[model samples]
Target: MANGKSLMTGLLVGGVIGGLATILTAPSSGRDLRTQLKQNKQKLESILIQLKDDSISLKESVVKTAQESAVVLKDVTADLQKSIQTWQEEIEPHKAELQKEISQIEEKIKELEQTLNK
Candidate 1:
């Protein structure tokens, strides 16, 4: 974007300098010179108008794209959070069952050790 702005500025400055040089060097009558200058002025104004319109369009497009991206990001984040929550819910029963089994095995091991000692 910066490069684009710099290029546009360079083109505008170059156009103005070129126009001035052409007008100064031309060997035309006073009326013809005035007419040429007027035409050049009109052309420059048209260029400016077109540039302004293009810049506005570019700005609108950038803003729209950014808004869309933000929405998509938010949706993805929400989805990820819901997925995590669902996964945790699914695993909870299995986790508790495994813990109960481990405790039962530990009790049996202790009982066997006590019998062996007796």
Candidate 2:
């Protein structure tokens, strides 16, 4: 990104230097040359102002996107935690029932083993 900015700056400077050189060599009257140079200066200033406004707009857009992304990420994280909590709540009662069933099965197995021994 820094390299791109430097390249653009170099191009603008080179263009200005070339334009000045061309104007100096042209066989126009002194007054006309001065007028043309003044016009060129105004145009360059306008381009620079527009470039600055564009940069500011781009910066604002990036910041807004980052902020929105952060909000979405936080919302997703909270929803996931809530879903986990709900699952735990729903499963706890069934877990106790399953434990009770296992204990009953173990007792039945012990009774069968004693009868077989007899």
Candidate 3:
């Protein structure tokens, strides 16, 4: 997209320069030169209008994309929070069993230490 814009800008600049050089080099009466200059002015104005329209379109597209991304990010965050809540709920039932196993292991370790000391 950026490349297309740059190419369009380069072409417009080249066209303007080429048109101006041709106008300057052409020999003509005052009336004819004024007419050509007027035509060039109209052309430049038309080009400016086109550029403005393109800029507005590009701006709108960017805004739309940003809005969509924001929605997706919001959904993902909600899902992750829900998953965390579910995990905590699932772990709740096993808490007492886990504590009992840890207590048994500690007792075994203490017994082994006392036997070694004796």
Candidate 4:
């Protein structure tokens, strides 16, 4: 987008400089010169209007793409969060059972040690 703007600016400046040089170098009468300048001005105006329309269209496309990307990102984030929550829930029962078994083993080892000491 920035490149497009820079190119457009360069074209506009170059056109103006070239037009002025051409007008100055032309060996025409005053009336013809005035008529040529008027025609050039109108042509420039038309080019500017077309450029403005093109810029507006490019901007709209960029905005629409950004909006679609944002929505997709939001959906992906939500899906990932839900998947993590589901995995946590699925693992919780096994985690609790493993903890219970560990506690029972510890109690048995302690009792065995006490019995051996006695």
User: Per-residue alpha-carbon lDDT of model 2 for 8-112, expressed as tens digits?
Assistant: 699698878988797878999989888988988898889888888988899899999999999999999999999999999999999999999999999999999
| Clash pairs (backbone) in predicted model 2 | none
Model 3, span 1-118: residue lDDT tens: 7887898789788988987897879899889988988898898789878988997998899999999999999999999999999999999879878999999999999999999999
lDDT of each: 0.95, 0.91, 0.90, 0.96
Angstrom error of the Cα, residue 67, model 3: value is 3.1
Worst 10 residues of 3 by lDDT: 3-12
The per-prediction CA RMSD against the true structure, in angstroms, equals 4.4, 4.9, 4.5, 4.5
lDDT of 2: 0.91
- lDDT by residue for model 4 (35-110), tens: 9999999999999999999889989999999999999999999999999999999999999999999999999999
- Candidate 2 matches the true fold with a TM-score of 0.61
Which of 1 and 4 is the better model by TM-score? 1
Those runs of model 1 whose alpha carbons end farther than 4 Å from true positions after fitting are: 88-118
**What's each prediction's TM-score?**
0.65, 0.61, 0.63, 0.61
Can you list the residue pairs that collide in candidate 4? none
Candidate achieving the largest lDDT: 4
The alpha-carbon lDDT assigned to residue 19 of candidate 2 equals: 88
Q: Rank the candidates by lDDT, best first.
A: 4, 1, 2, 3
Q: Which ranges in model 2 have alpha carbons more than 4 Å from their true place?
A: 1-4, 82-118
The order by descending TM-score is: 1, 3, 4, 2
Error of 3 at 12 (Å): 9.4
Highest-scoring model, TM-score: 1
